[model samples]
Target chain A: MNRYPEIADRLMGLDEAVSRFVKDGCQLAIGGFTITRNPMAVAYEIVRQRVKDIHLVCHSNGQALDVLVGAGCVRRLEIAYGGNGRYAPTCVRFKKAVQRSEIEFEDYSNYQMSLRFLAGALSIPFIPTKSGLGSDLMNYEGFPPDIRREKKVASKKYAKMQNPFSEQRDEVVLLPALTPDVTILHAQFVGDDGTVRMKGLTFADIEQAKAADAVIVTCEDIVPRSFIRTDPDQNSLPPFFVDAIVKVPYGAHPTACYGFYDYDPKHLNLYRKMAEDDALFREYLDEWVYGVSSWEDYLTKVGMEMILKIKANPVIGYAPGLDRK
Target chain B: MIQYSDNEMMALAAGRFIKDGDIVFAGTGVSILAATAAKRIFAPKAVIFFETGGIDPSLDEIPMAVADLRAMAGTSLNSGLIEAFSIVGHRKLHTVAFLGAAQIDRYGNLNTTCIGDYFKPRTRFSGSGGACDVATFASGVITFMQHEKRRFVEKLDYLTSVGWYKGGNSRKELGLRRGGALAVVTNLGVLRFHEETKEMYLAEYFPGVTIGKIVESTGFPIDTSMAVEADAPTPGELQILREEVDPQRLICQAVLAAPQK
Candidate 1:
């Protein structure tokens, strides 16, 4: 008898997972920060499946966010920051898309976005914070009034009211909670029983996963039950929270995964170059996304030598002295 | 005479502002360099953390981004974004954030969002990641900039992060209890806000940079009465910053120029 019968049933291929759960006009929350642990394999598969009109919600995303937006999979975006560190100060394709007014977009600070996810996770209607009190984030409503009536979109950008607890004129900004249709993340390990473990900084991944209706996790390694259970503290999420689990090694390639590898600077640099022009970006999609048969095939295109160079040291949790430039 | 880059000077100048027991919140680019320099050279006891929730990391290598794996390496504890923000505004802690922006106003309000209109920006930058949060919560903020007239604008295209708001007690009147812009560190000099008016005034011009050059470069009216010539970067400070803080010269590498007599 399979110890993890429920997880066994949920285990599916990346293509199957994307087709079944991700649909047109679904709200999405992607895990990871600027240069680490982005769910790239699923992002690529979404592109391959030509998933469209995704309303992406993010805090400070990088590789996967850029790829989805670049490949024209995203229709609406609510983001705090879109950057890839030193590689690209502002994500090239994201910058172009916003500058060209290709997608409906709104902005929030990282804390505000994180709080929104937290509020969603807690099943709250709205969350109050002092973060965007005096900035344009409070003034400008990026989404049009008509779009506000949509299912996932908030009714208003933000609402301000005086603090009820304080007799003095203490005011705060109230942000609407975000409950995305799905949240996807890449992790270092997922047990056969479906327990997930992510090393390094979790960013807002936990809150995002809890906030979503469905959660998809793609991981580098799927370990045995005994190993994952030995240290409960190390595990990130409970098995029941994860709706689908796909084991794809280097699932976050070109983005760092703590003890797994460093971000592939060479690839990121190439992407930066290719994403600069419209014609070249299409070629990048053809050669990289559409051209590849599978994740393994994609890795083969990335090659063995670069893999070895980017591999992280277990003790330090990153490839020290990697040629980041 | 020792020749130093502008980055080297800026890092040292900003690092000096940090003291022991302060919590330093660092952004990427020169801010990282300055934060590291502060810990290594100025304040060994100061704890360096990232917005991604890496508390007191060893920082064996310079992180290219706030979420770089290097930031998580050898950390005392590795948490996530919510926890990190908790520490930033913890009331008890004295958090000093270092940030860079595309444009800044006379009151130190920042624009990291977009140029032109918000709807169709001519130049779009990475929108305020955590700058707004830190600027609101941290005990103070030290901003980095390139001293150019266009960058030091009278009015920002968009204010992504609130500094002094409209100056004076405006930030306080806007409902922020504590934090405000502490100083502005640039390629040419250091600027501080007035105690009463809250307007930016030239506090220190670098050894070679003239007061007139600073005045010419600023887009808005600035007070020069309080301006004084800043001390040159010492050999010891330069050695530590170049050798230990950033051996890769990732952010510290800039065109070397001789200090004017």
Candidate 2:
């Protein structure tokens, strides 16, 4: 009856998958850009389990990054940007953490971060780019000297070298590669065969997956092997790369998943209001994250009206005129 | 006589800089408005793209952020970050990027990272997302700012993106092949770089805005000898920006008090 018997062992619950791969102080990469397709369900589960001291590497993450940092689960971060689209220009928790010096942080441009992941996937030690040539990203190293010597941290923020092939004066910034201990992503569909398919804008998820030692994927639906195999072009990653697969509908809530739903403006607006103050943020975490028994319970709190309101029109890929204000 | 908001006039003024066949890299807020205005009104053939890898999206609805789902819908191609950067620095393409910053200097260098020490900041903004990359790789950059004494500083607290890079051949000496600050659009007017020295100079002051106000608002001395009064927004231009571009008034709602000459 099972179309793909090979991947039957990989299918597991959210708790087991996260507990198995994500551990204390491990280097992690989360896939998404700003406000789209964040692995929120898994991020919440990590918070519920109280996974501590995570070293997060990302390019331009939004809700997931904010939630994890806000929950006090992250200790060190290598990121490009920390802001939601329109909700919070600079993520409230992230800004507070940086200003308070609670966590060690470093900054890179999106291209530099992407190229680092690409280098890791290519099995190269480092990569070169023209970005951040004269910028302070090259001048200031946010990580302390001790942390630089620690495992999974780059020895230097950046290095400058003359182009070996060029006869004239030419320079490029060399960035160390990033091979995360585990990479987490949320997708529109994952086949029973373990092939992952993302609907719109992969946004370096493929690169992050390839550069990680392990990959955990949460998806909206689990399709049959026969259905997913009919169109291989749509597949984002092959079966061998994904170590864990969990089927969780509305997994990327508060973040847009193309063809499924738009970002929850009402919820994000509420989060923005609560995240401003320390006491209010804790209460928000208690009600939204800790108080909820399960993802289903969380959905109940989100309510059916809000769900229907944010539902995307399949053809358009977002809720048209959904009063995003 | 037509009355236009600051955002409407700013968008139209920046839109005029775009031309046919340009690859426009857009950030959020007024930058998105200007990109849409450029395509619909000024340069119909110009393409608008996002750093998140949505190339030439239909943009039927205005996107609040570069990663908004609307940016991916009806796009010519849906790729990822790497592919998008390839197009930005592509030798063949003429890419023009639009950005925003918290602080800027006489050389047009921008600071979007932090306001204080590197170890601990008084204020930490969303770090250089892709502004640094586009400034390094694109053919030119147009920045949007609020004209204020604090914002237009003589020296940046932190240089997150290189503009002219200490002026003249400094940017080129730093190994970047092309791209530098082209113009700065603000609530009061437009500022352009000196042809040779690369220092920012007042190029245009909006209608009802005085050059004296601009000089006073700037943190450093600025050259206003070449400045002229910018044309007021036309009735047709305002209509397109209001009715068609952003009917919801998501970004164009703020109506500043009329400027006194």
Candidate 3:
């Protein structure tokens, strides 16, 4: 019944997938909105492998971006929303790095960045938008204007042109396409043929998959193509778009996966504290990163009880104790 | 008279501005509370749109962020950021917005990008997510922030989102299509913009609030000739807000600690 038997058995280990696709000085786009379903397991592997000078890209970034910045694995950031949620104070490392001129920063709003992905996915040169016309984010040199002129070029990607259709004085801004060298995404399920099914809030996942040169998918379960074909409405990304598939359960741990778990606030709080200081950050790396061999070992370090405690209560979509009733 | 917290009063003031069938573009936090209050009290047919691409969601609880899963699932339309801005936001007319600002000027210009300077900011916030787009496209925009001397500045340290730039005809010069920011709701009072000048002036003061406190708190001088005392929250509005809208009391918890004390 299926025609894609050649693409079967695409499942592989996390570290092996990271090593095979990611490299130094490569541009990497990560998919997730804030602290939900980010490819944190593969991100940790990138840190462990000492992949330096990598350019980071995401529309809505949170702990994962902060972790990579804290680990010194990033040299450039193409960002839109880089703030933490209400639970934490701020992303301290990202702020410090930007202030210290350690990282090249290019800023975009949520709409602007999404249009960039849409353009890339459509194979268009650029897309027209009315979002960033008057804001300072349109500068050709990028944010922190005097810091790194040569290294920051994303702001130069925009151009202003007259809207020919409008008789009135109107000008539309064009945002250039963004296609990264490699992209990483975490999902609830993926088929052996590399079809990705995200449970909730597919924020730029499909666009990034179609736009990137290579896409590495980390999923909780690798099911047969037949399972994915049953309820095809939830089938977000098709197999032709994905390059590799890695099966890693609890892949979005610390961050929540809808219908699977709730975010570990205590762990995020601990990370927020440790990420502020360099020595503590290194110690955190030792205890969490190099201290483990594989994803299974990482879960063991996190403890089974804690994992079970954060499991989703099917009725409310979060853990039971949070109901407060 | 019913006793109501300042956060509830602020929500009431914002909710009163919504019509029955208005389309509102809501941000996180206070905006959600205000819009929810509106839906329960008067504007039953009011449609709420989140920038995360959710249109008319069936919300059970306050979402943590605009991109929360609850914002997407079971919505009338579940699109992405592109459709939010391009197809629905920009193309449509008569859309309302609920905005937040770290600082605001007399012209209603907002600052959420940073403070001091763009290069070396004294304090930096997570830059505007969809605030700029909303400020640019929406027909009517309302800003909500804690009223304080530092926040009501004469000039913003950096203008992230434009309200009525330089007071008059500036938005038109920029080719933007919308009636700029119309009102700013604070814990102390309500401020409305002048029709021609576009300058914000004190329109009403909440219960137990004094005119002197508002005048001292504002960084710039304002017109108070048309000022009126605001009515206390009605029992029906308070009951719905407490029992159904914010039963968890997230907004109440924030405003209970200190309210013009």
Candidate 4:
């Protein structure tokens, strides 16, 4: 009888997971909306490992996307809007890149982009929606002629066709499926069998996970499968959907994870300031990403006091002393 | 009588457009303040759909971003972007929306896409996130923007969100559902679309602000014949704005109110 030795681990370190799944020029979708539950650890690892020419797909991007853009890791972006909310300055490097035409981008509305993921998840060729009617996005007019022509080669991203079911509307827009090579998500919990249980808004997590060739989940903790099964309704992704599970306690630090911690707005403000200067942004990567060997070391630099300060309070759901600032 | 900054007045004026029981697609900046004030004061049961997919969140503090976890606090349904927008689109969710614009035309079409030629943009802004969807799908839309000649334009450099869509039944002809711009709330006055032509006109003027000033600030000719003095912020509205809606002056700050300052 052939016997397979007991597997040393289904769980791997952050670096090994990133090295294995993320490749240069891959179409990657990182889950979360703006500042909430972003896969920051994985994003930072991708940057530090010097992955290049990534085609990013996101709905509303914020700091994590900006950091990669600042690091010159991204070559193309398919997004709706990218900004650090009002309290922080605009993502300076991203703006500069757009102005310089260093990165080619295609803009879609949030719902339109979400629909693309839904189409990918449902294994459909395309899905129709009225979101982009009369907007320049439907024609890809904002892009330079060459880029626009290149973007149109896919054809299905925005194909205008008559609505067969509707007599009132003559035409509708269809978005192509966006099946990324890999999708990374940061969640609140993952069961032993890799059933993902996400708290707060599950913004595109399940869809992106199911729409990817490989799904990597970085979670706060690995809990018992029985614990997840007890509340089966809350499980967002089943075991078969996840390719890898990484336990990173403060994975979404700086960004907030619902029910776990509050965002460090001050840190984000500091990052916004750093992003304004190209030299300072590189220095930030050095001190924050390369200067630290691992996630534990990064946490050490972030300090337990600051972490505890932003820790979520039970009743209010954000850090107790946060808004007072 | 309490004094109010133009920013606070804008939020208060925008809030006036929200009816009780209307589900508002609330985003960041002044819209959050306006929607929160409306929910707290006029429309207590109104649902707010944050772009984060939180519906009717019970926030302890005013959310800075639509996706902020503060939006998830006490939310009835913490869904995703697809579910929320599809709900609005398919369910006829009886929604209202708040939007901001870099440039707007007489037809109320908004431009947040670019400042110059589309390919060679002079100044590029963050493109429409959910504004286009909400504007197309909502039952009524109210926009908040500073009153500046550059912002109130004769023609947008590029159209990002369609309001009345070249006036008349064109919006409906374009397959838009039964919602379009109802008001444009600026510091100086309130502008509304013409029922027939869909052209914007000065619907109401605020205290100490003249129709001439509004006309001077706008790039296109505006009708002022039927304009009236807008209802001032009530004592209750002002108190809620100052004390509860924005105690930190986050939305009531001078930079937004006094742009030249």
Interface RMSD of each: 5.7, 5.3, 4.9, 3.8
Model 3: docking quality category = acceptable
Reference-based lDDT, residue B102, model 3: 82
How does chain B of model 3 score on TM-score? 0.94
When summed lDDT is taken over every stretch of 10 residues in candidate 3 chain A, the lowest stretch is A144-153
Q: Higher TM-score: candidate 3 or 4?
A: 4
Which residue pairs show backbone clashes in model 1? none
- Cα shift from native, residue A129, model 4 (Å): 0.3
DockQ of each: 0.58, 0.57, 0.38, 0.54
RMSD of each: 2.8, 2.6, 3.6, 3.1
Question: Could you tell me the interface RMSD of model 3?
Answer: 4.9
List candidate 1 segments past 4 Å from native. A1-6, B254-261
> What are the models' TM-scores?
0.98, 0.98, 0.91, 0.94
> In candidate 1, what are the lDDT values of residues B202-240, reduced to their tens digit?
999999899999999999989999999898989998888
User: So what's the TM-score on candidate 3?
Assistant: 0.91
Per-residue lDDT of candidate 4, residues A178-226 (tens digit): 8889999999998876778998899888889888999889999888767
Model with the higher DockQ, candidate 1 or 3: 1
Of the true interface contacts, what fraction does each candidate have?
A: 0.85, 0.81, 0.35, 0.65
Model 1 global lDDT (CA atoms, 0 to 1): 0.91
RMSD of 4: 3.1
